[model samples]
Target: MNFSSKLLQNAVEEFGRLPGVGKKTALRLVLHLLKQQDAEVARFTSSLNLLKEKIQYCKECYNISDEEVCEICLSVKRDKSTICVVEDTRDVMAIENTNQYQGVYHVLGGLISPMDGIGPSDLKIEGLIQRLRQGAVKEVILALSATMEGDTTIFYLYRKLKEFDVQVSTIARGIAFGGELEYVDEITLGRSILTRVPYERNVG
Candidate 1:
């Protein structure tokens, strides 16, 4: 193949590697980029590069940040006594879009999945425990998914945090089983936050 053809194929392969993009969609994206002006493609590539180069995890909450701390963590207007724990950055974005939560967040990076070899140690649980030990937070809200892994992670965190004096809670059942927070509507997420339940141990 010629240089231009090879470039197109490379772009398609890169796009294909994305989570849900197939060969056809990858090809479409490559063709779309090809039609754009050189400067436009440059701008797109630069933005993509900056996503990795500029963004960093907030030291306080583990959320994505352009600086040392995320905006939510830095905001004095937010309720510092509450911390919402989520499985990923997308979950953080989902809850933020709801505009209902006034507290800060702690992104666990992932859920506990034994089949996938992801355990509590692999998440940010240690950070959360340390944060609780600081005694500033009065509540830790588990905003994890309603799936099996989500439940497992929640239980694990609950067991560990039970020793702490802080109150522990989980989002309500407004979200359906097997549903992901990223796909849930903002209104549903807001309602779930409004109707959160305390994390009960040994419920029959």
Candidate 2:
């Protein structure tokens, strides 16, 4: 790729550093940005700079927020007794989108993946344990992803919380609503059969 200007090349290289962005895509983005007005470009750069400088992590859950406590943690409507443990802020957002769970969240920051050199000590496990020890929480929901790493983390957490009085539960895993048994993976299909729930009608 032949970039006439070093400034343009630098911008393209920086954009290319982003995940899933190829050099060609980065160059295209840089060219697009170059075509924008100076004021528009300033606003774009300013927003990015502001995000980097002003974004805060909730002290309680480590979720991204503008304040010390996130809106979810501060909400009085949320169930303080039920803490849904998740891998990251994305999981927190995903569950929130459903509007089904009214419980508070505990973001682990990451899973315990030995291959990735990530362990319990590297995550927010200590903070979660401390929060539980305070006695306000009655149930700890392990909402980690359905993977080997997720299973390992859940098992490790179960062992840790065994002495605690809090009830431990996992989100039900099963076939999708419209999925056929033949298409569903063996592990999920088997678990779905074993943990089948009664078909209850919604009143509303």
Winner by TM-score? 2
Q: How high is each candidate's TM-score?
A: 0.81, 0.91
* Residue-wise C-alpha lDDT for candidate 1, range 1-204, written one tens digit per residue: 243578788878889999999988989898998899999999999998999788899999998888898899999899999999998899998998989999999999999999999988999989998999899989999999888999999999999999988899998667776889999999888877887666583131
Candidate 1's TM-score: 0.81
Candidate 2 local lDDT, residue 177: 74
User: Which lDDT tens digits does candidate 2 get at residues 1-204?
Assistant: 888999999999999999999999999898899999999999999999999999998888888899999999999999999999999999998999999999899999999999999999999999899999899999999999999999999999999999899999998788887798789999888888888777773123
Q: How many residue pairs clash in each candidate?
A: 0, 0
Q: Which ten residues in a row have the lowest lDDT in candidate 1?
A: 195-204
Residue 84 displacement in candidate 1 (angstroms):
0.7
